[model samples]
Target: MTFKHSIKTALGGLHSNTSRSILTILGIVIGITAIMLVLSLGAGAQNLILSQIQGMGSKTIVTVPGRQPSGPSDFANVFLDSLKERDLQSIRNKANVPFAEDVMPVVFGSVRLSYQNETYQSTVLGGGSAESNNVMSDIFDIYPEQGSFFTASDVLSKASVAVIGDKIREKLFGDIDPIGKKVRVKDKTFQVIGVLGRKGQVSFFNFDDMILVPYTTAGQYLLGRKYFDRIIVSAVSEETIRTTVNDIEMTLRANHGITDPEKDDFFVETQADLADRLKTITTALTLFLSGVAGISLFVGGVGIMNIMLVSVTERTREIGLRKAVGATNSDILTQFLFEAVLLTSLGGLIGITLGSSLSFIISFIISKFALASWSFSFPYLGAGLGLLVSAFVGLVFGLYPARKASQKAPIDALRYE
Candidate 1:
């Protein structure tokens, strides 16, 4: 028989057992859907992180207190009090770090902000100097929508002036003007001088939900700690990032009296480094989930193999009749193999459709509810891989059954039930 005739006969055989065919392909459908969903979500998460990192610009460098965390056990280093005011001052000296364009110390803590009867718990960010305003404006593109940022005098006087985020402003003041109003932070009333424009999360920090204050004020009055959590530095140019990082390392080491690089209390990271780290983390997670999802495909393949074996047994007489009438072994093998491939291919297509629809619905719901950063993505690569894997599974698992069907002698098959 011709290849087309074999395919036609195989399709007819599947149609004759419609219920069984549907049941047999269900496993494949589930496996493909899981794989496609994992790939789509992974891609969306990676893109969100990369975009956030790119938004910060390439010239930015961050000096974080504590030893660089290398493993799960090293996470305790994050809470260490390593960076001090002396390290900030040493990095600020242009004579020592001429490549540094701007330096801003950051300290953050969760605190309650109250305006009369309304109270909200939110993260409070403290900026070390007036230059921090410019740093935030330039690197993070933060700008005041209603009023201007606090001036240099505000930082020097350890002023109780504050800049509120968009969400914070809405929750506290509603439609009323926030400028010149007072908000209570840690028993201290701070005059609202500025309201920031809508800036979403960056590097997992939700700017929209945070309030900004002077670092001196936070250290002295709120957190009551003199050490800084982190120091942000912008290079004079993108080309100067390495030099500035080196300068910062040298200055910080000297100030902290550290002789060995490995023994240094702080770790410096560039924007590129941060992007790479995030990408690595996301990629690892994607790979691990994909591996777990792959097990379903294996189960589906086994299901296909078992179903094909049953099909061969049930259609033994039909196969014998076809062989008795001039059909070759190759023809019988092709017919059975085509049926198996068709089953899985159709299942893969259905799975792709279902997975894509579900991914879109999830992304839409998350965006509507103002959840974490998420985007709907078409899993093109996942679909392609799924299709190829389905075809491969059909070939591998269907081979034994197809060969067994082809090898049965016509007289023996006919004599059997």
Candidate 2:
């Protein structure tokens, strides 16, 4: 038979069992959709994280205190112990530290802030110096909209001043200017020295939603804790970044005591390092999701086989009549097997279209709100490849039933109910 004739005959056979064909296709559709959605989400999240890291400034370095081990599974509780007041002074004074510009220890945690009748929960960051402006600019890249960042004098005097994130500004002050207005952190009141420029969400972290205050004030008044959770340092120039990071690591390792790498208390990472790691993690997650989604294709193929078997039984008399009319055994087998492959291939096409559409919708949402570059909708090659596999599966599993139909005795089949 010509290819066109084979396709026409296969399609007619499919239509004869519309409800069964529809049910079988549903399985493939679900499997493909799950695979597409998971891969898109993983890719979107990876892009979001990298963009946030890059925005922190290309050459910047961030050192966070690793979790102090209390025991296994309590790993999340570990954070850098306070860099002692004297140690912080020493770091600030290190002259050979390339660029030797600014070193600020930041204390951050969840807290409540209140202004007049308005109250809100917010993340509070307490650390500021003239050098802090450079570090913050490079990392968060947010500048003051009004007033100014806290001064060196402010850090020295432990001034009661704060730089508010845009979210807190909107919540507390609304249309009114927030600079110079007093807001309470925990219980003590501090004047808002500046309002930070609007920065949209980055890497799942929202810069527009935090509050910055003098580290000394935070140590003395709000938390009454001497230790800092994290420390941020800024270099004078791009050329000084690598040397500065090396010097800072050596200084910290010495201060922490042991020379062994395993005993080291802190982790020093650059933005580029972080982006690479995130990419690897997202790739793994995407593959895992795709594997899980492929399960539905197997189930769909099985449904096709079962339905084909039933079709063969129902058309026994027809098979016999065809044989009597000079149709060869191969022709009878080809007709039934062709029906199965056509059903699966059509389902595969529909699945590919729907799955791609869902991925694009999710990608659109991620780009719009997450400040990441938008990605164009692309066909999932895996899904298309999976369709071909599904067709093969139908061809293989449908053969046995088709051959059994071809073997039926003409007289016996014609006499059956």
- Please name the candidate that would achieve the greatest lDDT relative to the true structure: 1
CA lDDT, every model vs. true structure: 0.85, 0.74
Model 2 global lDDT (CA atoms, 0 to 1): 0.74
Error of 1 at 124 (Å): 0.2
- As a whole number from 0 to 100, the lDDT of residue 124 in candidate 2 is 79
Give the per-residue lDDT of model 2 (tens digit) for 1-417: 666776776788788889978886777667766766676666666766677778766666666777434358757655457366655665676663556566777787788999999999998777765444455555566788887888767887888888888889999899998877899899888899888878766543566888887788887888777877666666777787888877877777777774886665676666676788778778887887788878887887777778778888888888788778877777777888888777777777777777778878778776677644656445466666767866886788778887887788888888878
Q: Give the per-residue Cα lDDT of candidate 2 at 148.
A: 82
Worst 10 residues of 1 by lDDT: 128-137
Q: What is the TM-score of each candidate against the true structure?
A: 0.96, 0.84
User: TM-score of predicted model 2?
Assistant: 0.84
